[model samples]
Target: MPDHASESSVRPETPEPTGTSKPSRATESKPEGEPTERPESSEAPGMSEAPEFRDAVPSPPQVPAYAQQGRQPQPPNPWQSNRQTTGTLARLRPARPAAIRNATLWAAVATALLSALLLGDGLGPNLLIVAVPAALAAYFAAQAAGRRLRTWSAVWAVGGLALLAVPALRDAGWPTFLAVVSAVALGSLTLHGSRSWLGVFLGSVGLLSSVAGGLRWGMGGVRDRMTGSRGRWGVVFRSTVVAIGLLIVFGALFASADAAFADVLGNLIPDVSLGDAPWRIFLFAVGLVGALTAAYTAAAPVRWDDITIRAGKPRGRLEWALPLIVLNLLFAVFIAIQLTVLLGGYDKVMAETHLSYSAYARQGFWQLLWATLLTLLVIALALRWAPRGQSRDRTLVRTVLGALCLLTLVVVASALRRMGLYVDAYGLTRLRISVAAIELWLGVVLILIMAAGMFGARILPRAVAASAAATVLAFGLVSPDGLIAEQNVQRYRSRHTIDIDYLRGLSADAVPALDSLPEPLRSCALKEIQQTLRTSDAPWYATSWGEVRARDILEKRSANALVANCRGQGSEGGSGRNGVEGDDSYDPY
Candidate 1:
């Protein structure tokens, strides 16, 4: 054999010439892909590990037979150790840890300041109340979001806030303001790459997350050095609580001893008014705490992307087309019947149903409203699994689905007409007006969905959401209360079956509409309105533009009938929103 020999491809139990070899221990220690000795006949001198043509790649970490995979070390925490600000145990890790920490710190500060401002006099004259608080929340949220998500959210937040800030929006009444608030609520999903529904959900939860800031503060501040564990500053907390108790007791004692001493400690003592009052200072403290926590929750959002994304095999083309075809046919028949009814009008409805106009209108309106709501779900599912390929199946599914949306919109129109007829007979109420608004909103959403389907837009849900939000803005601008009142008052002028009791129950928003009434009807309406204004027990914060307008109406022209009608009637706590003569009007608050 040569003096310098290549590593062997074979191993023998015993040496050939010396009749001796090491035990099998050294052979067993070599790992996978290592140059191990194998007993073979046709292998080349240098190709000891495997054949020359076999591909090479790194394998899993080499582990000893005695070592367990479970015992491997974990990765380090992404966030650097911070002694101040924010939760150390992050609810969700941000893409950039440093940016998140800074953002959270700033957000907490902003939230505290907001809490201070709100708890003092509170925010408003409308949107200005929520502006800085909202911006702070948006800013903190933007820190963790990508540029695209932040940008989209910014557009919505700005638009929604600006819409709320309009003076007319306040005058429009609560429904209009609430409608707009719902639209803004959608902006809570301002985090980029999040689903719109998820945003809506988080936005809602964000409203109640006020205590999260305190939790975060506690988390970041509490840590053990020697034991390497987290610990709270409980001793200091208990001591502070005890000290406050002592101060309260001693201050009470000192106050009883001297008037000058009592006066001196006035600034030091807090009058929470733990007495017979319905509300006091501590109530505001609780509210501020909740607001702060909610701000923190918004700022440090836990992404629900993994849970929000539905996982399953989307229905195949055949599966999609089959149900959609059947559904479209049903809708077509319904539409056909609806079309016939539309041309027939009120006379046909009475002849066929043999019911009063209001009864006839009431029965189907509720069902159709439900149908409209249900159809939205059906349309959502069809879009979710709609085939995208340029094939007959995709075309068929799209066409059928679009037809379905159009038909549902027809259903919406029918529902609106029914409600309109009902309202024409009964006059306007809040519930009737709200239902009408919802139906119109549904129709608008269907239209958006149809447009999205035509263009094969992936953002179908978002587009629908945006459209719904826009409709709310539009509804607010038009003002639902004023519209209801105007339409009802006009109906009374034309039909002359005005519900005097119903008009009595109308809110301040309806005052302008009722103001146009003539003589006896005008006196009756003014009487109830005047009583409501004079005896209303709503708090200062609850004061509204409607109240102001109602007050103005009452001041400008006194109603002698109202004074006489309510002469003996007491303004009891049972009066609810209005206290004038038991609020006999049929108007629902």
Candidate 2:
């Protein structure tokens, strides 16, 4: 067969792209290894008999340039267009009924899931609220992809399911971050057969793909089908319009006629402003389209790199290291101060700093936390793209970096110790617990990265990702509230000073732990739990298993005399607010 691509031949079906010059036939190159033309076949052109071959079907006669000019080129196929216009979607779209129904259904499902996640049980707002919907919309959007997307889609789906499985643990801050990262990783793997850093970034972009996907889904054959059915729809549309107008007219008349009937009718059919309908319709249309778009894009993501244009070469190691070196020295000085303070213990800090234990503990923790995170990013960028193979003094740079990372661990430990001391003193809040968990996770990742750096570049990223995920997962497995409650209760038992107000503010996750407190404290805690449970907006269908379990604890308590005892005392300010001067109330912060 002739190498058509290599030859300067143009076929009737394959026109050159617009604006590109056509290859001249005279300048065409002959295929390699072909016998020389035998001195023009020992005959003049057109005068001698033509040579014929049996096996030449693959190599069609090349249309001459003159003949091509006489015969107009066929138009481009919409399906094969490189530019992704709506026609591309029209070509690849599924059946109209299937697309419309499935898109609508999945869109509703996505909205419902959002509602459930938002209004149902939760551990404050985090990544799942955003990511799960994207995953879901992607799941159903890829429904058209069928078996092609089965594995990756399933993995993405499972990751989302895992995220929603434990509501109480959702606030395990590091675990939540890891779970989101895992979901993004899984999404990229499914969408693009990638697990690299680029893949994760693309997965994030894919979340917004739904908007375009929805457009694609709508622009798909559905629009054509709708246009095709417009003749029939026109009559139906006019008739419906007339009917609506008449209904409004008669409804107003009837309402004016019978007040009671109008009241019943009004109850059954709430009034809607025609003025706002367009905006509502617009929003609704956008949501449906966006949902389907997200799904479609997630299922069949466009090549992200094709659109992305990175700017320039990374800064050299020396450029990065010089600044990093300065920071490392500063950190070294800080570490020296920290070690001295550690040796001196709380007493030395008190006398030297003239600050109380809590003040000393809380003093630099937040600043150190930010410093640790910033340093991690700095180290990551420094190690990741800093011309390692080309640099002559890279080993020395790495050793210096390794020492810096090791010193940073002491900073992490200091932060952890400081936070722990503060928590022990002030009792725990959701925010405090989240910070603690994140710091611990950061510490683990630092260790992983430091160790991985020693081995080689190949090991570092994978180890960091894996270790970070594992650390988060481990943290998520333990109910933070339960732990917080246990610690606080222990502190209270030992010191006899519990923060009743703070404990009262905790969510249902703390109920079981708080329940273990002695009578009056337990009663007061149960009242708070019962009130939170009673006032919950989560529908039964949307309730997480953890929430259900929490509710059951409340229900069982209500069934016994426990609820009555609390309720009876609740009116007497069981909240421990109004204490008589001589009264021995169990009120303590």
Candidate 3:
């Protein structure tokens, strides 16, 4: 047979003097060394054109524009490109250096131990000690992991420490509670480069996410080491176990051998009984998780600002302006009425309403508070929907929102004035003072909004947050319970009325103020606080400054005399009241 492979590979020559009479221009335009088509019938049986003889050929790869211009193609940025794959999970999965891992582990252990020792007592000076050290440890761990602390991180960390001092300084429940919340919020913002309201919210969420992610990352590292390497880690683990066993054995023998050594050991180590073991373990776990979360976040903070939320669709000038204008007019009318009431017309209005001053104040204050809150919400929504792209739109937004904010300030003032009147009639309570403080804060926030409007809103969210933190700090520093006691005592001196039961409910921070009351009343006021102080056997480390001062004050007084007078007052049902009937509207929150 003929050589079919060679025949198939070679292109068949065109016959001279083709039927077309002359070669077509299209065929003439074909490039040299290109393959020519052949009929299948001309080939041998079961043979066809070879693969190389096919009409189509792959094209050469195109050169990039930069490469063609004598520049090398830049590598894609890992941070800015391929967001889908390079997300939080991918970032968290990188192998940490052994040194960094060990440092993080040590920091977590230290935090856990500190928390277990100091936290079980109560909220006190111990919180300050534990929190500051824990923050420092997290900072060091982050640095060990090659994460540089940013300026805002330092600011937030310092702010958190300052807020944590509230518990050490004030024993008032609400102030301490608010301070802890503010501190935790600031802590979350430490690593996350948050600069907006959305960023703040996501930073909080990221804190929780870091907790679980850090646990998984840490456990994975441990699992890998346990399964992969039996050389160094195994010996280290075995040595640790041996050391622990030796310590337990030697410690017990030595404690049994000497009384002074036993006392020292008992004092040095926390007494973890079987019943308290679970609680202590829980506290330790919290500390470990908290520390690991902070370190993990610091090492790889999610760029939450990258997640952009599109603004609300802009409304037409008419659509946006009409409601706000109507609302502004309504506010103007309300302010007019409020101003009239603030003037000498308050008595006439009260008489027309058939309510006393306190009664009238009570009826209106809560409504005004709710109105103030709702107005803030409305302002937020208005700004969201406000028209912007045009000069006219900008002016409209500034004018309308500005007026709304200004009117809201007046509402805030009205709420505060109403609360003041209510307090004057009934004496101050924790709830009254707290609400007043909140109203004052709202007023400050409205002022911030107006300022932001005048200048710019870029810093408004952070400014608002700082203001809130400052308000809480100031509120704590003022010692709300002490102030309440002092005000009520003064009210009693002037009006000959006070709420003894309410005063008794205050914390030890009120001791100095309550101690100034006349005999039986003083005894009744100090009765509960004294009981708390007497019963509390908290160690010196857990005692707050407020608690220490209260103890000192009580020590100088006659407990026996106070107890005797308190018993007589209790027998006579001497729980003083402001003589006004209790109204259901009086909520002390």
Candidate 4:
């Protein structure tokens, strides 16, 4: 087979030289080490030469310039990729500190300072400004400490040790300051365990402090922060509108003849303090929570789509019982007050010297009852008779009813104003019958309206509509109190009276009588007597408010005596009054 194949290849070189070329064919047959090829004719029929063997696939082209270099073409493993990603993040992250010692230190220092200030035992309004700042600082510090502190034990020990150092700073009355400082430190430490709860606790504490101290400005800031992230401007705007309405309505309800706008503003903006204890602060907190919660709850349903199903009419067990609840609250308060007056052992001495627990309770009870009843009545009237459907007469009825309500409110306010003046002039402290009679009448009117309006277009609308209506209702019905105006004047008058009258009776025996009076009254009496002894030549005309009022009556007094002197330093062309005159400017200084 090999000889035949080699002969066929050699003969193919030349057709005519086949015999001579056949020698090469002999050489091809005996080719040293090389394998022999068979003749084409001897191969299988119609067979072709086998193709050259090479790699099954071609090599990939070189990577482009933009491609990452120095990496092999390895298939990706999801697990490995994830690990790399996570490792990169781990490297970039910051390490947690072992302990927030600096934060703890600062918190401790602040707490100590507040405690020392509190020790005076007469901190009162004097410490309000400082207490608010202390509370805020403690809140943030707690957040930091939460990151580092691992256990409640550590938190308490650190906070306690910090407070213990309070006594060492004697110059500031560390002992007293320690009490307040310790309270803050402990409270803040407790907040470290849970941030959300911390926010709640801190918010609550801040609220209460604000209320007790009458620190409306401070509280307003806190509320802003809590709700700022909500991105719900409508909620905020509506709440503001409602608040304005509430203030207006409340003002109208309790408007006093002696009320002045300046005094009202002052009351609205408190000096703030914690010395009043946690309870008073709690009330402040409650009022703030009430306002904020009302705002948020009222707005939440409108904005949150998922919660819309729960947003239908407020028809729960709570809604059904609301009318009864309101009535019970009013009656319970009234009954308690009556029982205190008729059966309780409160005497005239107790009333004159200091209000007993029962007296304050009764006062609060009645005030609460009055406010609640009026608010409920407003609600009932709005729900029942506030016009339904899109009929023109309904709108007309609403307008008429609204106007009539406003008129009725004004008339009631006017009557209350006259009565307050009458009581003040006559020195009649008792007011049980007046408040109850007023609330009772208001509640009756409300119940009747609620009964009539139950099945109508739920005329009160939903929360938004209700809020708008309530706001309008409040403005139409309520009036701001001039408690500040009358209180300041009354205090001044009381002091002036004691000064002029008490000193004239100040023989040696009169010292005991002076001591028997309260501290403020005692102080006024002593100061006048001492001054009289020091300046025996002074005339009675020099010490009279009648004289001061006479001078300032036409002059438009600039604040008080000091401000009057300061007026001389004003710009030469400007008048001394500068618009702060009148009763409005009396204590505005």
Instruction: Give the range where candidate 3 is weakest over 10 consecutive residues by summed lDDT.
Output: 567-576
Backbone clashes in model 3, listed as residue pairs:
none
Evaluated at residue 84, the lDDT of candidate 4 is 35
Measured with C-alpha atoms, the lDDT of residue 109 in candidate 4 is 38
Off by over 4 Å in 3: 1-48, 51-99, 144-146, 223-269, 561-576, 581-589
Error of 4 at 423 (Å): 2.8
Instruction: Give the per-residue lDDT digits (tens) of candidate 2, residues 1-589.
Output: 3777646465446654543354456335756676434343244447444443211123445687867789766678877857766643344333342454445454544554354333323343323454455556656656665526555345555554564444434323344455655645544545543334544456544545446545766566456655778787588669989998999899989999999989877754433457656654554565455455555555556544343335345566677678778888998899888887777666866897788665577667887889889988877667555555555557756776788788889899999888877776656666777787778878887787777666755545434545544554555667766677777787767655565556666655676677777767676765766766678654333344445667777776652335444423322323333111123233232
Indicate whether candidate 2 or candidate 4 has the larger lDDT. 2
Tell me model 4's lDDT, rounded to 2 decimals.
0.36
Please, what are the lDDT tens digits per residue for candidate 3 over residues 1-589?
A: 3688789668687665322245468768989989655543344444444433232343456667898899987788876756556555455445443333666666676788888877887887777767765676567667766777677777777787888888988877789999998888888888776888787777755687778767776676567767778688889879999998999899999999999999888766665668887888899888878877777777667667666778999999999999888998998999999999988798889889888777689779889888989989998888888899999889989998999999899988888888888788777877788778888999999999999999999988877877887888888888998999899888878866677767788998999998888877887788778888889877666667888899999999844442554422321223334444445223343
lDDT of each: 0.58, 0.59, 0.77, 0.36
Model 3: how large is the Cα RMSD against the reference?
A: 9.1
TM-scores, in order shown? 0.63, 0.59, 0.78, 0.25
Q: How close is candidate 2 to the true structure, as a TM-score?
A: 0.59
Clashes of each: 12, 5, 0, 17
Report the lDDT tens digits of candidate 4 across residue range 476-505: 122111121233235334432122221323
Per-candidate RMSD vs. true structure?
12.4, 16.5, 9.1, 24.8
When 1 and 3 are scored with TM-score, the better candidate is: 3
